[model samples]
Target chain A: MFFFALIVKPLVLFILGLNKRGQNNLPVKGPAIIAANHNSHLDTLVLMSLFPIAKIHKIRPVAAADYFLRSGFMKWFSTYCIDIIPLDRKNRVNKKALFAECHKALDNGDILILFPEGSRGTPEQMSQLKKGVFHLVKDRDDTQVTPVVLRGLGRALPKGTALFVPFNCDVVIGQPVPAQEKADDFIKLLASRYDNLFQYCVTHQEPEQ
Target chain B: MFNIPQNSLYTMLLVLLFLCIGTITRLVLKAKFPQKDYTELRQRIQSWWWMVAILFFALVFSKTTAIILFALISYLALKEFLSIVPSRPADRRVIFWAYIIIPFQYYWAATSWYGMFIIFIPVYVFLFLPMRMVLVGETKGFIRSAGVLHWAIMLTVFCLSHIAYLLVLEDKNPQAGPIGLVLFLVIMTQLNDVSQYIWGKLFGKHKIIPKVSPNKTWEGFLGGLVTITILSGLVAPILTPLGFAYGLLAGLIISSSGFIGDVVISSVKRDLQIKDSGSLIPGHGGILDRMDSMMFTAPLFFHFLYYVKY
Candidate 1:
């Protein structure tokens, strides 16, 4: 975490030119979920850098176990450097056990960063969101779910490519959505909130002078 | 201690005085008018202080530092341009190569390699980038991508580099040196912008180009032209080898070309259908918004001085 704050945060902000908006929406204390769109590997790094370095230990990005923990080195880096909460993607029988760690993190007042897209998608294009976020927040009406929209990172370091290009990225955080009672209602509310925040990333046609 | 040129020192002091005045005026405005929101004005003044400090150190430190600073500015300007402009996914590698050209271009300017600095972008990279894009094999939007990328390089890198080149020019004026020339051009160009805004607010009636830039007017244009021409004439003898008459001509070139540059960028924003390029600066918008005039003034003023004196 010390190494990340000292090195990775500055390096990511400098290279990516992270232009953030509505940062005040980020919950100062957690038991909260920061749900953002997934586009690139740099997404996790960029999101982590947004929080204060002192709370680095309290922020945990919920990543896929198989993908992030594929190799020995990646597992070490993902667990230690990024401090991610690895959730098993293939565990179908024990869904309840899969979310035990997430529930524990929330109970302990830690912020969990979740990309509801489940996996990386095409550059600059939003994909179908997974229902895992709804599962995590359902029945926990007190836990705040903040919707964040990330644009231009896919172009910078999109999936299936190792070459990094410097592109200016926008991070738009929206007001937290109240947890809905039904799973479908919660998912729909989250998606709608995302759509609203995503509008901030779109370049509107300004009236000509 | 670095031997600061006499004219450069005097110019720095003048800039400091202006900044102090701006601070006082901002404070007075806030205190006197409690209801009025002075956020934009305050942010503009704050950005000005930062810009002046950065430019001051870059000029005072050494020639290498100044060149590096301009190179970084070119990088930022180009980044902001590329970010706003429509680009194809296939041209991603092409964009990477475009950024790679910045350092090499600045290197030529820093080493005083006039041969490469002049033609490297226009001749070599102009031809080279299209070929690299062709190799990517995405024929769709090929021409548009090539045109956009090439133009971005020209405006951001090729044009802005002239200011850095000014610092490396042979010291024809022993009293002022190259730093003075830089200060003179930058100050005159920015002064023309501020003077035009003030004059336009006071007496501007006739719209110059309503379609592109509605705010610009004939009154403001003429006011800025006269103000900059006289100011340039006054400062040229102190800063450059040009006499008062030649200085007026230099002023004429900078003021007119600066106006054209401002409108040209305005046209670009209109075409793109965006208000401010990016929110990099607090009140200024982006590096491109601030540098639109410099894009024209730097090259024109540099060449005019080179032709007349060097």
Candidate 2:
């Protein structure tokens, strides 16, 4: 089960180096947020595999409901094995039920993986973070927020492309930023934190050059 | 005749001593330095204990079995090294040479070709590796390409083969053989590492070139050297052909060389701006982290055994 994928995933990516960093920041306990910058769909697998899923609670990734949730098998795999929480990007205001589902998951002390950018953007700069993360954490002050930056996954498998590039993926997990005042400012800080985290992972990365 | 069973027991005792010291140091650090998550430290101690257990079992096992296991270890360590450091597509042929040539260097020792094992990687492979790369003729990343491949060969293949070469040392008694010698070298080298780390943590004040390895200290070097020196003298008669005095001196040499090795690899990671080389080993960072002490210690200890025993 868990051991199968753990062995297979790394075995498959053994040649690529799968260079990961900052896994120490993952809390050994519950109600943790993996606030990451999304680049490509493979970003899901990158973070999921990088973190010790065996030790930590199953991660509920907030993937795009409109895109990934469309297919029956994709939804099931993303929800169960990959454990993604797909959210609709088109109807943000109308997506109250999705927000409730995320809140309930976090309330039960389960791990929530959020792509704060709401949608995948160009590889360079992160976009404005949607309010879901802030709204979810505004009440539960004890939850830990981790800014994760997935730098290479996009290039490895970019948007609207089926090709899986063999480039190395770096997963940088920044130090936990606990819940605080100024919701908008905190979101900005989280985004900036991801930016800094990404820089550190890339700069500290073993350059094949 | 030097008693094989006694030497085996002695090795086990030393391994236990090191394990206790490492574990205690970690516990003390957790109590004293409450700020840091000493989990990594604890994990390191645990891994070392497992490593010691493995080594102990390997030594007690038949000579052929021990050599075979060591060969497997060298393969794994080298594989981990090659995975992290990128090689050019053109250098793929050299890599073939690297994987194929390296195991034979150890195989030479296993088959008791002492002379050939000693200089196989340095003299022959060193010469041939460059020529093979030259023939492939991917001149685009000439410096980067050749440099990394060369480094991979030197660190992974050349340095590591010395572990296997330890099998060739003959003693007055068959029981007091190369197995004890190989086990001794590894034990002493790793002990030096643990001693230095503990000493550094306890009394380390001077940075000892802070930028290179921030955690290392002059205090640790002195403490580790003195401790390993004494242990070396005590264990020398049982393990090596060297007298107690030379064994002590070898311990001192190996410890200091091991420090330099750690620093040299530290500098490599520093140049790359990486913290740990890789996370293949849970507690230990990467192959480089595990092999840092081995790089310098292997060559130094190998030659020492070569001159005295051969």
Candidate 3:
């Protein structure tokens, strides 16, 4: 495993030039919510490589249980390699535990990578964000919700697509939003932010800060 | 599979010894002084150690392989540079010329075509690129667009190829071939950067230019020179055919120039209102971050070798 990480990974990067952008927004310390719109499975790896191994160890990615946790190898790889948190989307009863786990991860000062879109959608349109993000922020006032927009992943490895189209991926990390408002108001605020984010992306733009 | 023979082990050991001197100096400086905020100088040092380690391998490889690797490095570094800087759609035609010139320049180096590689980009590509764009009959963004393309090609493609040019030596002394010259140039230039940064961090009492580069200090400048001189003295035999005093002089030239190079790029980023050139590398901020040292180091190092060794 160490050999794969230190040797194989860098070799691949050296060959491909592993072009990435907006990686500096990754916090060097403490807990934050990496809220991104989902596009493909490779999106997780793309985001993970944007930081060092030590920081990556502290990040817990929230993946849907019904899809990824079905197989034992998938479960082990996801859990061990990326610290994926399998949320059973089919069962509402399981959501309570999942939410608690996210909070627990945050409380431990670990980063929780969340897909607010809930599922993959058409590349032309982003998935309407589930209210889980709003609730998560509202519950933990201290936790920062960082908006991470990943482009070109759908092209790399699209959902329902078997072939991996080799392409450059860009990961943009926006400034963190402090949890200050109520759930409904926070949801509206976040939704509007998502709307602007998608607009910026579609326009192929950056915030001129 | 061009491998360096075991007889070259003594030379490799000398390179390692020089690396140790620089690394130890850095450690002492880091311990003596630490930054409260996340500054560019702090970040450069953090990644430079790893850069030195990679360079160790580059120096150890067989002469032919080392030349190819440096060419690839120049290519990758240039690719990262072009991606971030915005070029108008009109510049597309000229960019095609720019990409092809990358490999051609390296081919000149590989075949020991010294005269052509030196003049190819500045003389031929420089004239040809603008002429091609002018023929396209696009008046829109004529100056601003052409200027960006020119800057990218000059800095990324032209200046960087100087590292490859180091592979071709006028004197074919097998004792210290072109590979040794290349190694010497890289080590001396990089050592200057690492040492100056360490000195500045440890005893950087007064900011030289607060607005342009806040972390730079007079104390650091003097300290870095002493450190680099000592390093040049140690690593002279393995990487270069230079005597200790000559190596010290060469190291000083590379370090001072590299410092100026870093400041120039920093000013560009500030003007652009961006923290980094572009976040292409983790821990390391941008293409510019990795290339900041190289921009000045390459041209300066090449000429120093050209004058001394050639």
Q: Between 1 and 2, whose TM-score is larger?
A: 1
Arranged by lDDT with the best first, the candidates are 1, 2, 3
Task: Give one digit per residue, the lDDT tens place, for model 3 in A35-110.
Answer: 8878778667666666676566777888898878779998788777777777777766565675877778778988
lDDT (Cα, 0-100) at B189 in candidate 1? 88
Predicted structure 1, TM vs. truth: 0.96
User: Per-residue alpha-carbon lDDT of model 2 for B1-310, expressed as tens digits?
Assistant: 3235566566678669867987888888888989998787787778878777776677666666677676656655565555445445455556656767756876787888866876787788777888888898878777786677667677766787677667665654354566777777887888899899999989999889898888998899999999999999888777777788888888888889999988998897787666776665678876668878887898888888677766
Error of 1 at A208 (Å): 26
> What's the number of clashes in each of the models?
0, 1, 0
Interface RMSD (Å) of candidate 2: 6.2
Q: What is the DockQ of candidate 1?
A: 0.38
**Could you say which candidate leads in lDDT?**
1
lDDT (Cα, 0-100) at B132 in candidate 1: 96
Off-target runs (Cα >4 Å) in candidate 3 are: A1-147, A150-169, A173-188, A191-209, B1-8, B14-54, B135-138, B170-173, B229-238, B278-282
User: Candidate 1 or 3, higher TM-score?
Assistant: 1
Determine which window of 10 residues in candidate 3 chain A has minimal summed lDDT: A200-209
